[model samples]
Target: MIINKILNVDDYYFDVFMSISESLTGFSVNELQSTGLAEIYYKHILGQIEAATFTEFLNISKNILENSYTQDQLNNAIAAEIFANASTEDIANSIITLWYLGTWEGAYVNDLSYKEGLVWNVMHSHPPGAKQPGYKSWGVKPVNSNI
Candidate 1:
């Protein structure tokens, strides 16, 4: 039930983000947004830290979305090249890195909130202090891992 306040766009924008993220990260929206991570990404791109921003990243992503490509197009090598190159852009790369590591661009900025980071999700491990895997399961595989 969380709503976006920064961009003021409708559901389509989130859908775009979901689609792009699924393509890039190979994770479902239900999986990725379970802890409101995507919205945080949107906030980061909009104006979280001002100088630390991704307006250009969002623009390039939206431009790709605007192109005449089908959902299947994102999986192709050409589109992969575009995404790969776009991710090289400062903001876009940070976004991709965040999607993978679930942290902000510490290489660029020191502020990083790893509360719901994707690495823990993918590794089938819970956030260190938030959700304990269970009793004495430190090295055991997570019971509910989707990866």
Candidate 2:
């Protein structure tokens, strides 16, 4: 049987958020060995990103960054805006993580279940050609393996 695939906004937000965060922080996606405050901040940023799609998150983050808020303050502000009505901490955390990831300069496609054909199509459409300098690479692969 063929499995129907539907893209989730939260997943898209997470991918984009990670890309942006890496760009802004100058950290490789796999090299973010964060803990404590950095970890907390990451979570919050992700939350904000997950709460909104790429375009919405970008607009919100741009507005916040242009203001005088510190990184922490900006993160919280984004969380508040994204989770205006939601009360779940998990959702909030996701939003925070999303925001942190969105700071970078690339698109994210974190859906593991996506078909290879579909992923390639999306990647080609967004980037249009070979990978550019300072942008995260996109493709399909396992995050970890024990083979």
Among the numbered candidates, top TM-score falls to: 1
lDDT by residue for model 1 (1-147), tens: 121232345644565665556556777667777746677676565554453234444444556655636656545532554546744345545666777676664632222346566677667676677676778786665577575
Give the per-residue lDDT of model 2 (tens digit) for 1-147.
Answer: 111122233343344444434434445444432311334334544454554444565554445445524657655665566445353333334433333332222333232211211223323433234324234544444345343
Candidate lDDT (C-alpha), each: 0.57, 0.39
Stretches > 4 Å off in candidate 2: 1-53, 85-147
User: C-alpha displacement of 37 in model 1, angstroms?
Assistant: 2.2
Candidate of highest lDDT? 1
Query: lDDT (0-100) at residue 23 of candidate 2?
Result: 37
What's the alpha carbon RMSD for model 1?
A: 6.2
Cα displacement (angstroms), candidate 1, residue 57, comes to 4.2
Residue 21 displacement (Å), model 1: 1.4
